[model samples]
Target chain A: MEPDTQNGGGMAKLGIWLVVLLLIIGGIVVYGKRGEDTKKASVKEPIKIGFIGPLTGDLANIGANTKAAVEIGVDDINSAGGIGGRTLEVVYEDSQCTPAKSTSAANKLISVDKVAAILGDTCSSATLAIAPIVEQAKVPLISYASTAAKVSDAGDFIFRTVPSDVLQSSFAAKYAVEKLAKKKVAIIFVNNDWGLGLSKGFSEAFKAGGGEAVFSEGIDATSKDARSLLSKIKAIKADILYLLVMPGQAEIVIKQAQELSLKISIFGADPLEDMTVWNNAGKAGEGVMFTTIGTSPSDDFKAKMKAKVGSDEIIYSGPFAYDGLKILGKVIGEVGTDGTAIKDALYKVSYEGGVSSPKIEFDQNGDPKEAGYAIKIVKNGKPVVVK
Target chain B: MDIVPQLIANSIIAGSIYTILALGFNLSFSTGKFIDMGYGVMMVIGGYAVFYLSKILGLPLPVGILLGLVISGLVSYLAYTVVYKPLRARKASGAVLLIASLGVLTALQAVIAILFTSQFQTLSGLLSGNRVFEIFGGAITAVQLTTLALGIFLFVILAVILKYTMCGKAVTAISDDEEVSKIVGINTEKIIGSVFFISGVIGGLGGMLIGFDTGIEPIMGLPWLLSAVTAVIIGGIGNVYGSIAGGFLLAFAENFGIWQIPGEWKSAITFGILILFLLFRPRGLFPK
Candidate 1:
């Protein structure tokens, strides 16, 4: 028994020394791994960008298309050997096309993802919601589709590839009064930030151009029934009807108006240039005229998008989104990943080969300076650029 | 334009839609003794079934409509047998049943959205062309006229059934006292199930008509459901004839009220009438 006890005590001491030696080795390995991780993080870290848009809900189709375009842009940049050997990474969050959801997404992108910049919030309301957050974080926010005039004053860091509604509405007003020679106008606008801005801007411009807005009314965006409103518009009997609504609502409005046998000329904004509207509205959408921003996509780029998205009818915003990413990448490459530095660099960008606009430059409000609108008319159930 | 004739025409068209929805809601609510939120999704099912048949499968309009009605009825009956019947056997409270109905509504809406993408689809091809008529200087469409006629026909048929038929008498008895009627050999479950099927058919018809008139979407059910519930509350819950009267009254109030106000105030006017009726005449215009 004594010999057994002595042997057991010796084994215990040996086991303790073995544990100590193993712990020492484990500590060295862990310390070395942590050091390597820090070195990689400092030198080879990816340039993370945040993308917030409606990935689900009512506007999911538009969101998906925009995301696809942005991905193509990322692929183009990375294939050109990424910005200084650091790969571009985009973290996407669904804004649900709502201000509340956009705010939450912006918080996550800024505080959690630690992104260098944000690209998105396609809707005007959502972009407006995230503006203050990004401005506070000193991060640059580049929107590809938001067109509200209020976005100009949203923040110093807020920028958009799409021209403001102020420009489009004013141009539309001039064309209606001068070109179409319509003196009396009836306006029906969707009751939202984008629609309200267009309505106010168009009405003011029309009145300034010596045209009278005989009737003006705001309809809820989700409203499906417009017979009563159309009846009222019919009674007023204006020369031109300005419908500032989305493509879905626009289709219903046009069809219902045709059913009512109202012979007034109809006009719309850029959103009406969708195949969905043309297909759904049937023959009623024929001869309807609208305004859209001009694009200069290269033949190769167009072919690439057609192959990537499996459709040739790319949305107008898709090209703008592609340009937005390229612009952001150029600036990021020139000025590094500092948000303030990128914001400063965005003002000086003179890009020549953007997919949407031929020459991309920013004004004081971070708006494109050399942008103009073009007229499109539906002919033979398809949108034809009016020269 | 003089707003009076347009307002009257608008009221009639809106009233016709509410009447059909309210009738079905009243029939189901009387026997079930629960709000039956699933009733709303059933309307969506009816609309989508008709869309799938007429638009996708290239079936005739009439055949698509008949199949839509049958599909909705069978789905409603299944909902009761599979979900509500077992819960009733366990003696669940009305609140629990109502919550369960909401669950059914959400799940069914998601399923429909998955199948038919959440985009607005129109039934423009079915009608060929919209025929318009002038009534007292107000414009009305052929579809609107059909909706009015269908509402009247359903009302007359339902009134006759409830007042003069044995099935109607059995349904009323079961609704009044399910356990007592069961004791008296009324087969309360069968009567209630039949009521559900009949109500589902009417609701499905209403859905198809609305889809034909305007357009249909996966989330189209909730608005129609709200209108139906408002009519039921104003007419007096559980009263068949009261719902008819309530439907027209709410329509007139909303249409006429929005004439002077902005058009955006139209939905608000509907709830305003509901609130006034709830406060002043809590039992509704015609209580059982």
Candidate 2:
């Protein structure tokens, strides 16, 4: 009986020890699962990109249209299983078309959001403001619109989907000197980075191409009265008036010129190609001509944009913005979220199926290799390509 | 083509617009004893109201203009009752009132932006076709001539009223000392409200004219307000006729200043003149 009692005690002790071993194994399995969960969470996190543009201010139309195009690009990418099975997210900030606001917005996007890349800053002023910030942070900045010539020298990380104003301005110069045979031209431009760059580029190219710039004036973008400037241009009696202004301001200048019976021919940059110019200026914009970047948009892209934006009146920058985001996604997918790696991939990438152009490849200066400009003329309150 | 005649015409046109804006600003500032920053947004309201009435709703031009004027006056009266009057009842300081006015300005501008999308719009289509008249080798539009005529007429009428009429005397009395005027049986609030209405009408007219002559945008008000404020400061803040002289003087300075310099320096020249006037002749030409 004593031996039997001792055996029972030994069996109970073994049972307790076996229960302890089972609990220990279960705890290890649960901990290992937690560790696996954390790894998966890190891998499944959404890839975030930042967008900055004039979402609420003067250039809101352009910014909003570009945003719509970017949305389409994002939707397409995500629908195709996103970039390497992770969802893509875009955080937008309003630049207000101003430098001060854009700098702060860019800083917020870079420091707070810790985004991998940035798209937009539609205005040249805003792009130039954020260029140094993104460059310093080693984040790739792809401007969809900003066409200032100085943007070419912004930074290594700075790139634009749209061609520089250099090409458009040179094209304008050639069109004025060779096509229209205008020797003495009066240049009136908005007093902003883009306008100033166009003015400089057009003047240099025109002079180099054996045409004379008789008078040049930079009108304040906020100034409504161009009568004084128009008078000065009239005094010079140039054959053509080259306007480097936006659609709204361009409409005003054209109407005012008509009211003053100033009969000089008017030429402008890309912004004048919008329906706004024709609608506002009416018959005054009848014979106006301008140079615009890129070929005509593809029918598929146009239809998609019309569906997305709820209007057929997409701005000139819309297609380029779409292409910009797609290129960004492709680069990110190819090389991952590292800014340096993405930028390097971008430099080496040659995207062919973008809406902006048939083939888009960046040169050393971060400009597109095949950026070409087309001339458009207004007829019956509509922009028609000049054949 | 000598630029002198054109420069003179340009200065006169700009001066006319400034005169109208200054007169409106001066009326409110004098009677209210505070800078009504919201007064700037009233111009936008006026322009947009006309746009909605004529362009959007397909009303006749005259009807749209009349309704726009009435709407502008009513909106200003509402602002006084809704915003300034309550603050005044609380005995708010001028600084607080100024801040409140700024808030009103920002809110109103944002609302306009939301409704109309900050794009520049024109009212030239309402005029059928703008006609040009050549004068002394300078070109003038029918709109500019009308603006000048309206400015001159309003200036004369306002001057006459201020100098001779009972209502004008009451306004002046209230402006000089509101508490004293109230003690002396002047309905101070009523007078201030009327002054606001009158200023709003004048500002609306200025906006409509400018819209016809050039174009109008949500941000159009601030530039006009800036010019008007400069005129008021240079012309003596409380004086109506002084604002006219100051307006013309500034227009001339701005136009002539840029004649020798690049056009980009126009704003610099304008601010430079303002600074010079503030430094040397604080009371301005024809001081109150």
Candidate 3:
């Protein structure tokens, strides 16, 4: 074989370098043109809503759905003569539900995006992660569906569209007793502040409602063995199972319960509304039920969502997100993006057609108070309006 | 005595799953001298395979298990050949490899989410079919029994291959010193590739077993990796038998830790113990 020559400043190297530079320039021109179109449409200077969630992790489904819903909401608001005569724009950052990511996003939303009022950072820990930043920055932060009681209690600057676990669990236990008519229950909750907190509220409420949480079991969010968890449930012999799971394990408990041959009804929080769980559960999910704030705003609202966003993929929290923007837009209209004025104005803005829940009034703790819930059953593989 | 029998049974069930991960994790790690964050992603692929087959395709659970194993194993091999081989050829450092693995991890994780949509799903096999055995104060399910059986089976096969097979000797040679083994008669390239395949198989099997027990979620991999790593380290890395010991110890610490204080503190306790070991005895409980 002939001896191979090293790259002695060959023309081939120069040709390759020239192509690389051309590709970079081409990419920039394409992106810049798209940016210009958006700017011409006046989207660049629109009223901004900063949002955060785990856009690409275990919490992706819930976050993606919420993002989609908010996009629809903003589009609807903007097209309808815009909010406060200003087009609404939403900027999103992925928190991945890590505290570090949440803090960075929260700071960026305040200091960088300069959003008047912010939304989301789904996980309770994440919301708590950014709580101090939002509070100190005086940016009125509205979390759509996080329900750890600590969220509303974090401070006055933090307001949530979803009811706290305090209300959700009491309402859940009430449904179990009054609706499902089951006395003994198995509480299988993900082991976290969120799970433990919901379990506590449900336990207290269930006992108060003349029922007992026979066996309350905890599994780490990363647990792999539902057999042990199910065996313990079988051991308890609960008449009904209350699973407080993240989107990760919600379907697991449902199917594993089928394996254990325990035919008890499974009730969970709104996180169970995830399409993955619904699709995974399939026929097994026929009798399953969970609590949400309320049903879709109206048939027309849903039809609009179906046309604008993908309907079958809609989760419970999206409607609430739309309501969040509408509510914030009103606040901005009244107070003109001043955090103090917006924060004070939020308590006074009363709007009908609030998504997911009933009424929009902040309780002493900044959680929505006295909201009716939506409890639907999966009939024929679809969530039928079962009152 | 009631708790003891149950604890022993529970420990074995948990240990079996962690063993699959630890054994596979240590094997490639010892020889290649690089960690594969993508191993967890391989487990997710295995899990999704089983779920799609058994649930959607309506295939039998056994077929699903085979499919999951084959799919995940092939994916792992292809990933190494495509993404890792070039990096290793260029003599990339360990940190660069870690970052590359993370990239693979992120991309694989995204693909799984896009396909399954981040829902918790399970394998539908009668292997767990509501069969209950009341053993003492605690009752163990059929699936738990099967998991124990699977663990023992893998351990036995691992022993046979490692102690009595030629490829096993080659693996040992490489683990001892990859550079020295390459200079010797052993084909280091072939051995390294085979090690990755076997490790991938272990990961796939782990997903199947865990899928039967709990449920399979994309995010499920991190916790499994953490447990397996803890077991490997505590039992002595690269020591397969020692990992089984480490698995039990870790499970026991997690479960019974709740007994002393509020049960929610189990994780705090588990991590606290992990930190203690790290600070005082990072060599692990059964250091090789």
- The residue-by-residue lDDT of candidate 1 on B1-288, one tens digit each, is 676887789889989999999999999998999998888887888888899998999999899999999998888888888899899889999999999988888888889888988767777667788788888977788998999999999999998898899999888887788889899899888888888888888888888888878777777788888889999999988888888899999888877776677777888888888888889998798887
Number of backbone clashes in candidate 2: 0
Off by over 4 Å in 3: A1-44, A175-186, A209-217, A226-241, A257-266, A282-289, A312-314, A353-359, A363-365, A374-387, B1-9, B49-71, B78-103, B114-117, B125-147, B252-288
Best by TM-score: 2
Q: Is candidate 1 or candidate 2 better by lDDT?
A: 2
Worst 10 residues of 3 chain B by lDDT: B255-264
Kindly list the per-residue Cα lDDT of model 3 for residues B1-288, writing each as its tens digit.
Answer: 234555456666677777778888888777777878878888888888888888788888789889889898888887788887789889999999878887887798788888887655656443444465666645566777877777778777876787789998888888888788988889887778878877888888888777776667777776777777777777776776767777778877765554334344555765777778788888787776
Which segments of candidate 1 are over 4 A away from where they belong? A1-46, A56-58, A107-114
lDDT of 3 by residue, A171-264 (tens): 9899899887889988888876788889999989999989988888787676544545565566557898888887666766676566546668
Q: Between prediction 1 and prediction 3, which has the larger lDDT?
A: 1
Candidate 2: segments with Cα more than 4 A from true spot: A1-40
Per-residue lDDT value at A184 in model 3 = 95
Winning model by DockQ: 2
TM-score, ranked from best to worst? 2, 1, 3
- Candidate 1 overall lDDT versus native: 0.86
Provide the lDDT at A144 for model 3: 81
